[model samples]
Target: MRAHKITLAALVVAAGLSLTACQNDGDDTAATTDPSSVATTSPSAGGAGSDGSDAASPEASSGGKDTTAGAGTGEQSTSGKCRTDGLKITAIDNFIDGDPQGTVAVEMKNTSGRDCVIAGFAGVDLKTNEGTLSAERKGEPGDPYVLKNGKTIAFSVTYPLNETGGTGVRITNLVVTPPNETKSVTLPWPGKPSLPVTDGSGEPVRVGPIGSAGQGG
Candidate 1:
């Protein structure tokens, strides 16, 4: 009877121990469990930002297109006009006071790099300290200039300078308006009127194609 009781006691103890171990294992699993909530809140890592940044874009994309044409490489040039590439109605050439009355041959260069269909005429206005002079059209019927890609066209016209005669004349504004883009070139004429080419005496300068001896009034 004593042996049987001891055996029964041992069996009970072993069963209790097994149950306890299982309970401890279940508690450990519950502790590690997560409450399903957080998802994609922030960026995982380095990703594209909202700020548009295409560092590897082609050069054409950087400079954009020049109307119908493409961007010119470093080898290309805009010629005499400071209007630069893709400029419209650019003042490529200018003759200051070739005539005593102050004649300025306005040379417009279309740096648009596009084939421009000739349309409205280009006007040249002479600005003085007094005020603005009437705009004059160059050539017959003020014919439109049909400039090809990277081409320059010059139109000569005369305008009156300031009443006060001198070598320097102030130009209030000089603009060339084309059918498409309008570009302007302006220089402050302070004392009187000075040409791109001046004399040693600092007199009125004369500029034009060779063989044209301009007379001053």
Candidate 2:
């Protein structure tokens, strides 16, 4: 009877071991098949951030393009008359053979920072140290003369030549007024020369609609 009991106990122990092995295999299979047990990386990780950055880059580039398109890159228009304060005036003395009068060129340079226009003739007066000697305006009105900074335009002034018999009028000051302006600028007469004293019956001593430099006055 005792031998029979020992055999039965050994059989029970062997069955318990087999059952435990089956339960462990089932637990491993359940762990492998369960979705929560799986080790999975998030879908929106480093690669997803890179893709999002690339998409945003194109959007940023598109936004910059729109901004550029809204703003223009053309030169603004700066057309206007040259002011008297902005003009740098000079005189060029020249002579011609057989002419009864001496000719002088009045050069006007734009000293301002922008572009401007000067049209028609300039008003000129030949004055002495004592008082005004002769006043003339001989500029012919014409097209607008657009002048840029550092650009020059000139017109000619004719003055009666000094004669030996004391007929000449000595000029000390040259007062010049640009067109469309009431203000005037005074400059020294070329060489402080003299002009023939004449009555107001003859042609004007000043002649021009102002022209570009080196061109006909």
Candidate 3:
């Protein structure tokens, strides 16, 4: 019986050693296979990737630059004096009734291709058959006149009627100069325009200030 007990005890010790070896192997496998040791990959910062989505994506790369920055806003803007080379000057004859005076409208039209601004009065004088009739400005100049292309502004010249013994002075030509202009334009007198008196005395023949076309005398 004792010999049988000794054999059983030896078998028990061998089984215990086998169990301990199994547990040690399990621990070694777990330590070697830690999650931190596993290699991981991420997208490249240089935009070098297989998907190409980092650079090729329209929405992601659209914030690079504005191609239309500092572009012009398609419209013309200007300010300065009106050029006389682009202006057309003429006279409008509307005879005044029942008086020794007559109304002559001196019209200025802007034939220029651009916009302009004109201010102050025009320099005017009458060329008479007898001699030149030096006249003076009548009223104060109006505000700054903004003249656009194909637009017209006007001023008036008043002189005496051509009645016998009434201003015997005969008008042959009308000379006009725009405000702030060195050049002058001469308009032919349609008919014989005369002043009430032969000698230049009182405001003989007066020229009014420049005004817009829509304004009346």
Candidate 4:
């Protein structure tokens, strides 16, 4: 009985020692593991921010520049072409002494307040008792003339004079059309009623291009 009691006490001490050794082995395994070695996810390049808003692009970051306004400052503004309503027309007798051709100077003054352009030949016609006779243009059309406010330009009409008082057309009025205009203005003939003869070209009247006031005839 005494021997059995001692053996039983020894068995209890060995079981307690084996349990302490197993607890120490578990503590060493937990201490050897590193926390930094755990896998984690990272944000992608140019991804959204933490607040869930998209990142700004290169164009949006820079302040937008205005490419339209005041871009045409280097260009000049040009005046419009002259119209008949803006002009005051008049006729003057421009015939010289002993000259075979009867010359009439038709003058136009720009009554409009703005500057205007007058280019090419003016259309001229002679109103007679028989009918309306249109004048033929002569020479090259010159450069455009700028007529300012209250400025004047003139053109001439030439025809063979009836010095012998032979059969001819009796003129009553002069009808004039400004350059680049479809409208017409009429003015009375400046002198006594006279007859005009047509030249070999069958052109009863000849009209010249627009020029300065005193350049006509």
Candidate 5:
């Protein structure tokens, strides 16, 4: 009977040892694996964070919005200075026999930004195939012919056929300078002098660049 009791005690000790070993193994495994290590990826797109905000739409690259102010419409008159389009030659007329003496009419329009004057118009002449070799203005010679922007002004410059041998040859190389501002433009004439319309007229025809119209060109 004592032998049986010894066997039971031995078995009980072995069972206790086994239970303790199982608990120790469980704690060691838990320490090695970190529970706080969560995935940083987004749930919806599974996308990762980038250096900038959300991806830009295609429109952001192409056809982007323009924030700059547009150029003035032809309707608005200019102020302070003049632009190239300000002074233009609207019409060129030939009166076969308007006056007893044949006369050629050249019309000019002031489309200045503000009150402006014409300094001079010269160079090309319709009468002479070549540009006008000499040009002369009588009234306000080198004086500013003033105009409130937008109104068309006609100046009658009669070239007497009698004085110079000219028929079917009108006027050319006409330039006008303004008194108030220095900015001047080459008024568009019947034919373009340069080889190509795109080419710039040789020397800076000195009416003035806008800001300098009154003071410079």
Candidate 6:
């Protein structure tokens, strides 16, 4: 009877061990097959969705196309207005026939090798031994002139003839300043040494607005 009881106890212990092993195997299988666990281990987990919605988005690709569309046109990046340093200026005496008395044309040529703009009136001053005489501006300014490479623009200066034969101001040089520029260029007077004018007169010499090369006079 004692042997039989011992054998029965051993059988009960084996049965309990077998049941625990089965339960542990079932738990491991459930963990490996779970949907959440499979998704976290996938290679494309955070990338574009399974339908590729994020990869095909318009906002993602539009920026690259916009940046390269109009890069090489060059017209949008044109050089700005002309400056005195880029011009070749010359004074022409009596350039126009039948022009009003004592009129001289000053021409400014664009030597900048690029297109630029010139407008309004140029500042003109006659340099004499006594002092500098500023020219009075006449007429309203016209449209702005676009000076192409190697092209020219001009303006006219009208001075009193001093027909009275009295002693006149002797002009040694002409100081010319382009419109909107602070610098100036000095050139020798084109014609006579003396610019005859009535003394103590208010703004005897007059300057006109800029125009086409020969049209100013």
Top model by lDDT, which number?
A: 6
Selected candidate, larger TM-score, 3 vs 4: 4
TM-score of the candidate numbered 6? 0.61
Q: Would you list the C-alpha lDDT of every candidate in the order shown?
A: 0.44, 0.72, 0.72, 0.75, 0.42, 0.77
Query: Residue 202's C-alpha lDDT in candidate 4?
Result: 47
RMSD of each: 16.1, 17.7, 15.2, 17.5, 16.3, 12.7
Q: How close is candidate 2 to the true structure, as a TM-score?
A: 0.57
Instruction: Mark the regions of model 6 whose C-alpha exceeds 4 Å error after superposition.
Output: 1-77, 95-100, 197-199, 212-217
lDDT of 6 by residue, 86-133 (tens): 999888775355544577788999999898878899999999877998
User: Once superposed on the true structure, which residue ranges of model 2 sit more than 4 Å away at CA?
Assistant: 1-77, 199-204, 212-217
lDDT of 4 by residue, 168-196 (tens): 66888988989888899988977436665
Tens digits of per-residue lDDT for model 3, 36-102: 3552223344435446665466764554445334244222224367777878888878574565567
C-alpha lDDT (0 to 100) for residue 122 of candidate 6: 93
Error of 6 at 90 (Å): 0.8
Q: What is the TM-score of each candidate against the true structure?
A: 0.35, 0.57, 0.58, 0.61, 0.32, 0.61
Q: Return the clash pairs for model 1, or none.
A: 100-216, 167-193, 168-192, 168-193, 168-194, 169-192, 169-193, 170-189
Model 1 lDDT per residue over 86-126, tens place: 43333323435454555444444456656543434443445
Give the clashing residue pairs of candidate 6, or none: none
Worst 10 residues of 1 by lDDT: 208-217
